[model samples]
Target: MKKPFIFIISVLGVILESCYYDNEVYLYGNGSGAVCDTATVTYSATIAPIMASNCNSCHTASSGNGVITSDYNNLKTIVNNGKLLKSVNWTAGAIQMPLGGQKLPTCTLAKINKWVDNGALNN
Candidate 1:
């Protein structure tokens, strides 16, 4: 009887532990619980590094499908044409980027959009 009771209690404890829920915002936010910082986004600081890490591998001069994003001028072309945001945002009618990979994080997409809205400046 004792052995059976202990086993049942252990199983119930495990089940309850597995059902714990974490708040999405809390899990992804800054220490103070603030969300993404899109306030001062810039090309060289924000957008360029994002592209380098997530896009330039295949979108560079030698390999892109006529879409070289390794430099500001080439990147501006895509930004101007709307392919950059469309692809990264996985919007319809646009080829999803980092092809065969997951969409960029929401914060990253937000920063890119902010940069574009600010004119996709070379700064």
Candidate 2:
């Protein structure tokens, strides 16, 4: 009686936990995002979405390396790292963000590169 209920509860808990874990990126690096400038660095609306959608998972300031992609400061590091516009953007090496999201599109990549080349202004 009690044992049966306990077993059912445990199984249900496991299933629910698994279902709660979501790694899917709802939005990809769509350069169509709105623009928001922060003065020093141009926080390309499109760029933040991609980072938020992909890198923020493990690179948040509170996480391991405290690498927060919440803004352009951290994002510039990406360009300086030589992987900003590359297929695999990361500091040490290829990180392939969003864990398993689709590869960033060329237009999106080019947008990021252009924004950086244009002084990375926050406009």
Candidate 3:
């Protein structure tokens, strides 16, 4: 009984701890630790860095998931269609992007939301 209980707790612990991630992609890391001020998610300024540092590695113009987020048009298509985030989480957290432990920072997601709210502009 103790073994089962310990195993269950361990699993739950892992699951809980894996709910979020700290470091991955930042829109404009000034090294100033001021990401909160500009998570507006833009193609030229914000989204570029995030997609480049994180998504481009697996989903670029030439390879990976067939994602061409390098340009504003393709990115706009993905974001507007709501497939950008959804595609990354289709595997039930097993493959939640950044290809690692948790997932995107809450702040980063917030920026994306902001961008979405602002009409998913390329600015």
Winning model by TM-score: 1
Best by lDDT: 1
> All candidates: CA RMSD in angstroms?
11.2, 16.5, 11.8
Task: Kindly report which residue stretches of model 2 are placed more than 4 angstroms away from their true locations once superposed.
Answer: 1-44, 64-66, 87-93
Q: Write one digit per residue (lDDT tens) for candidate 1, span 31-79.
A: 4546777767888999889999998999888898899888999999998
RMSD of 3: 11.8
lDDT of each: 0.84, 0.59, 0.66
Q: How high is each candidate's TM-score?
A: 0.72, 0.48, 0.57
User: Cα lDDT for residue 20, model 3?
Assistant: 61
**Cα lDDT for residue 17, candidate 3:** 92
**True lDDT of residue 51, candidate 1:** 90
Residue 51 of model 3: what lDDT? Answer: 75
Candidate 3 structure lDDT: 0.66
Cα lDDT tens digits, model 3, 38-69, are 43356678878877876777667777565576
Ten contiguous residues minimizing lDDT sum, candidate 1: 23-32
Q: Judge candidate 3 at residue 83 and give its lDDT.
A: 73
Sort by TM-score, top down from the best: 1, 3, 2
Question: Residue 75 of model 3: what lDDT?
Answer: 81
Model 2 weakest lDDT span, ten residues long: 21-30
State the lDDT of candidate 2 residue by residue for 1-123, as single tens digits.
799999999999998998763321222323556432222224556667767766777777778264556777786776676655553442355666545776665455555655677766666
